[model samples]
Target: MNLPDTFHLIGGDALKTGTGGSLEHVNPATGESSTLELAGADEVDAAVAAAREAFGVWSGLAPMARRYLLQQLARRINESAADLSALSTYESGMPVVYAAQMAAVGPAEWFDYYAGWADKLNGEVIGAWDFNYTVPEPYGVVAAIVPFNGPVWEIGMKAAPALAAGNTVVIKPPELAPYSSILFGRLCLEAGIPPGVVNVVLSGPDGTGALVSHPDVDKISFTGSAGTARKILAAAAANLTPVVLELGGKSGVLICDDADVDSAVGAVAQFAIAQNAGQICTSPNRVLAQLGVYDEVVEKLAAVAGGFVVGDPLSESTQVGPVISVASADRIVGMVGEGVSAGTARVVTGGSRLDGPGAFVAPTVLADVATDSRLAGEEIFGPVATVSRVADDDEAVAVANGVDAGLAAYVFSRDISRCHTLAKRLRSGSVSINGLGNHMIYSPFGGKGASGYGREGGRAGIEEFLSVKSVSAQL
Candidate 1:
């Protein structure tokens, strides 16, 4: 993978010294590490200023022109999928197979999806009274803070909509996995997105704080932990800037008695548990199975989970790979081991680290986990899941809603009415019936309660970067 020693964003060249510290990035698949220069307050100010300067010009453009440029970026993203996928595996420990679909090619879909929205936006005229209309205007400068788990995907999620709405952006990438995002900045310029329309600042929390707190920044959209969101909220409060946040989740996977057994197990064990080392917010790790299917689901899920071998992420045949870092692996292992030792849960399959290099945590499925325990309630951003038995659909909904998070829930059942009923009762942002028609390219993805607020897909997402101006004239 081609890596840059210093991060220089397009309009605002950001190769500068930050409040000094180690900017070393470690490859989770190996122990090797490299360093990049951090952006300080100066870089933040420059990037913000550039974004502010460019916003008027970008917003003033004919909508079709913006659409054409966004589509060009989409084409570039598709062309560069392979290199970006490798970066995801190297930097975030995302397995290469899934990285291609998610961290790489997936962004192309986002750009295309939002690109179409650029020219389609329309204002409403209130014909009941005087000729009054509401015009949707883009917020000036949007600050997009993306997480390490899925850099390109979230970058596309945040930036595409902002740009579609005619807003300029300054992005702050996670310190651990900044490679793909840094490359993305160059892609913008190559795709004919004018300089200052998209800028990236490389820094830790200090530099991020500088960008979030900047007076000129009009909007902030972040995807990370709730704790970090609190700090960002505090900073944005000083400027009273509106923010769109997508935070952590301990999403539930509900398998009803009448559901297709193999399909449910496969979605949970094969996709949700194994993908990205379960680093995504919608991991669907807190599994609640109805009593009739609980034992069978547990047995089948164990076999499927155990079948995956933890190894190098670069290997094509490897099903499971290392997590983002050794620290995360250790935490996930401890969460399971401690729960099992405390008699709160029982391990159904692999639960310990492999005796090899890399930050490998074997795929784990813990059965009979206490609903109130950490393994069930907390967000374990690793390849670990906790299963519990529910007496009925009501109990399943209750147990699923018991957690503080409400990002997503997976419900499996042949009975459509029962599925809708449970989906209604379950407190989640989006409910997937039989694992379809939800959280997709056009779905509005977000969470409620502790999962944070604001949607990140489709038209709702683009509206996040826009403000409404009511225009009326006396006739």
Candidate 2:
């Protein structure tokens, strides 16, 4: 694949000095070195400083000017969609087609979606005795920590709004997949964004603590595990910085007896295990099926899991790629093994690697998995799904809400009333009624409870990057 043009810390044409630490970008699909770049505390500081300086001008610009630039950026992203897709596939180790469709095209979708909202991001005229309105303003510098999985989507989601709302950004990319994130910065320059408006930095395996804890960072937007979110919150607290965390989920799917088994099974499998190898925070980890159709559902799902081709992500025919890494694969297998040891479920398709090299795992399915099993209770961020039988729709809802995570849920049923009923009782931020409906850019996307606070996407997304300022002008 053709590599990115060049990676640099560009702030008004200045390349900041670094501490000389470097990160080796590896193509997980081919197990080859892709890019090597600087990563250290010093580098992090420089990026933050760049954003700090740019915030003055960028944040001071009129909302119209900011919106104009964002619109232009969206157009540039559409122009570079092909190249971004290739780079995303090389770095993310996902199927080329899915990578293009999701990481590349999905980001473009976000830019275009958020761009339209730029002019519409309005502050409300509040109820007051006097003439008063709450004007929303951008924070100074936003510190966005993006996960490697779906990096482009989150980056665009975070950066677009942060920029549209007149905030400069210093993004701390997951070290494992910094290549595409860095290239995205170059695209920003090509899109006519002034230098220092957006800066990209790589953090070590320990995580981007330096960036999160930095004093200059006005706000923190993170997407990762709940365990990591805690640390980020604590770190940001020291600086008294505001934060927006979109954390993990052990999400569930409730399949009612009245549901179409084939359609339900297909929908759950596609979103749960197939998408990004189940790396998504909203991926359904547990499938709570009504006993009436449980057996048929399990059988159909097993067939679907068994048929998925797992190997190199770059292969056009490969439906599922390896887990993030060997360690990640091992963690997922171990979770399944725990279920097996507990005698709660049977590993129907895969529980281990299927290939000779790289971190490949068979598309694993666990049937008759007990509702209380670790595999069913925790967020297994891999292609391992637990299927459990529920006594009724009530029992299904209980099982689905048993976990602390309330991110996203899926309910499949033919009866409209049953669908609406289950959807209401299912404790999640968003629910897919019959199938996984396409998420509209105008809708709110986030979770409640342990899944993390705050919302992203649509009007809520842009507002997350903004702060309210009440103004009363004397006439």
Candidate 3:
């Protein structure tokens, strides 16, 4: 992958320097290192000022005219899919093919998906005696804080809808893997986006805090860990600026007593890791297998864990790759060790770090993990599986809904009625009856409690960047 001359794009220019010191990354596979300057308060102020200036011109354009520009961006993204996918793999150590599907193809699709909505934003008319209708208008400057795990897709997820709703954006990308998102900002310019209409800043916490707290930024959309979300929320509260957050989850994969053992095992095995080495926010971290099949489920899961091909992410044949950084890998392993030492979990298969050059952890399965234990309850963003037994359907439902998060859940059962009943009881935003890790872009995706509030994807995503005004004129 060819590195761009610089990583930050502000007001239609690629900047080579920033206020803070440089941020560096060593290639997970090769240990080769690279650095990009970390944008700071001054940079944040400039990006916000740029977006604030561009808002009037951008929002004033005819909806269809805005659509035309966005369509051009989508086309360009599709043409450069190969380069984008390669860049993601180089930065995040994700499987190249997975990167192509999840990150590369996603931005183009999101742009096209929302482009149609540009002209279709409708407001309802209500009247009994006099004429009255609602108008949905852009929220001015929108600050989008994107996570490192799925940097490319998260940009499209937050920026496309915000742009389609007539709002200008200042994207704050994490320093870990900001390359693709920075490129995205350049793509906007290449596709005819006016200067100051869209900006990207490669920054760490200090800059991010500034962006979220800036009074000129009317709205903020964030996708990241729950811990980070809290910090952003605290800053936004000062201005009372509304925010939309999509955070991590310890999602449950519940296998009913009637479920086909093989199929249930397959869903847990694949979705638990999802080929991104389980770094996904909605990856099923805990498995609630019915007691009738718990033993068999654990046995098969262990076998599947051992079968994963852990190697270089750039290779097409590699099924599992390194986690993003050495620190992340160490945290994951330390969590597992803590669980074992507490006597709440036992490793049934692979557990230790692999003898390799990159930050690789062995794909692991911990059988009979206590349902109430930290190992089963917390979000473990690694290539590890925690399996526990559920006495019956009631217990499974209770355990599934027990966590503070409710982003997603997966259930497998031969009985159709059981699937329907459990779907209603499950607190998750999206529940798969007999599937795993399947997300529909057109559906409303979000959570109820600790998973954070507000929604993204489909028309719901577009609305997050808008505010409604009720206009009533005497007829």
Residue 411 lDDT, candidate 3, scale 0-100? 85
lDDT of each: 0.87, 0.79, 0.86
Q: Write the per-residue lDDT of candidate 1 for residues 336-379, one digit (tens) a residue.
A: 88899989999988789878777888898899998888888889
Q: What value does the lDDT take at residue 144 in candidate 3?
A: 91
Clashes of 1: 0
Please give the distance, in angstroms, between residue 218's alpha carbon in candidate 3 and its true position after superposition: 0.5
lDDT of 2 by residue, 428-468 (tens): 88988888764436688888889888888888888988899
Q: Model 1 reaches what TM-score against the true structure? A: 0.98
Candidates' TM-scores?
A: 0.98, 0.95, 0.98
Misplaced by over 4 Å in model 2 are 5-8, 13-17, 205-207, 473-475
Clash count list over all predictions: 0, 0, 0
> Model 3, range 51-75, lDDT digits (tens) per residue?
9999999999999999999899898
TM-score of 3: 0.98
Score candidate 2 by TM-score against the native. 0.95
TM-score-best of 2 and 3: 3
- State the displacement of the C-alpha of residue 401, model 2, in Å, after optimal TM-score superposition: 0.9
- Residue 266 in candidate 1 has what lDDT? 86
